[model samples]
Target: MHRLRCFALCATLLCPSPLLAATVFRCEDPGGHITFTLQGCSEAQDLQLHRAHNPTPGSGQPVPLAQTGKTTRTRSQAKPSAPLVVGEQGDGCGNRVTGSARRTAMIRQQVLAGMTRSDVESALGKPDKISTQNGRTRYHYRDREGSSRQISFDDAGCVKGKP
Candidate 1:
């Protein structure tokens, strides 16, 4: 009985506790800049609260994402659960500039969030300089006015934040 009690006490002391959980906020400003932080955002920006906890190994559950209204094509879902379409406000992806080809051509005149490298290239023409680091790609451009602009893309080749 004494050995059992000692073993139990040692196991209680040595075994790791569950990973710490945290509350994160995803905020997007009116201009379409997205930021994730522990601190909350101002009322102006759209805010989303995400409770993150590290599940034990072999839990067989996926990590939770922010509950945007739109449905995503998850591996487990046979069909999209929600009836929302792409480019909607609550979609997991950011606000994309979508419309008819002609309208999109006009929209692409100015770089915006949720654009692809090809779209940006078509809008602003080829970049003057290109660099890649940490799986992120950046394009540097010099306009006729001698001003400079830089756009960055994530590993998935989509624009990151607002330009």
Candidate 2:
């Protein structure tokens, strides 16, 4: 029995046990580098581990998922989301949110055709680079991790990108 326990301990130390594993998003880049993280990745081949969890602590039962969307957001567990608003510097529009929170709220929105310049700015923060030529302009937005968006505008200061 003691030898069996020792062997089991050695085996565990060599190979990770799935029972203790947490769900993660795995991404394989084109350069053949693989990365694991808890956040979503947009520019790579991705694999997500679906984990079953107990709703209540000490309960062995797994929570049942609602079958309605790509991913379910349960109202019983969902927190209130902040609304996106834009105003002058002193109008209390950007005061309550952190820089990351601002980015989160903005990035979730799509830049639609015919959106005003100010509306685009409200949906997405300032552009990293701006270039204009022949009455068409492009605003480049780049996150620190190299994810980017290029928003083009027509001569009328309205978005030319798809909704």
Candidate 3:
């Protein structure tokens, strides 16, 4: 279903129309999952709109998009039921993670509670902001537009607070 929606949106948006101003939305769900949609991020505080400079011929009517349901997936393509426990710096053993696409997907699914500061930084890059309270520190990272998530570390450095 998600793939279908994305494909439909891409088809419609990719269809050039002089009178149409396409609205592409980048959304970060409450759980911090990221998605691009045909409509706006309903609850996003950091929405951005991009308009095509070139115009095509159309009466401003939105293009019709195909709505094919989800396609079958192979075993290898399946996501893990539980995210792998990565190393303190990303992979379980001490190492700097690489691979932009894979790293990003992994970061999105990482379990933060046990992650060290270096692991978080290596996965998500620098935090947008940092603060401390009662001897504990928090790191805030921004996602898709305005969505933000934070990880707090207790005195011993394990993430604090419920996920």
Instruction: Candidate 2: give the clashing pairs.
Output: none
Worst 10 residues of 1 by lDDT: 88-97
Query: Considering summed lDDT, which 10 consecutive residues are worst modelled in model 3?
Result: 88-97
Tell me the tens digit of each residue's lDDT in model 2 across 1-163.
9999999999989996445435677777777777777775666565655553335555566555765658678988687598657755531232344456545656886565556567668897788899989978899999889998888877767667455
**For all candidates, what are the clash counts?**
0, 0, 5
Q: Write the per-residue lDDT of candidate 1 for residues 1-163, one digit (tens) a residue.
A: 9999999999999997776688999999999999999989999999999998867667877765676687578688676677866653432234365645424664657776667788788788899999999989999999889999999988877778753
TM-score of each: 0.38, 0.33, 0.33
> In order, what lDDT does every prediction score?
0.79, 0.69, 0.68
Candidate 1 vs 2: which has more TM-score: 1
Rate residue 135 of model 3 by lDDT.
90
Ranking by lDDT: 1, 2, 3
Which structure among the candidates has the greatest lDDT? 1
Q: Which is the better candidate, 1 or 3, if ranked by TM-score? A: 1
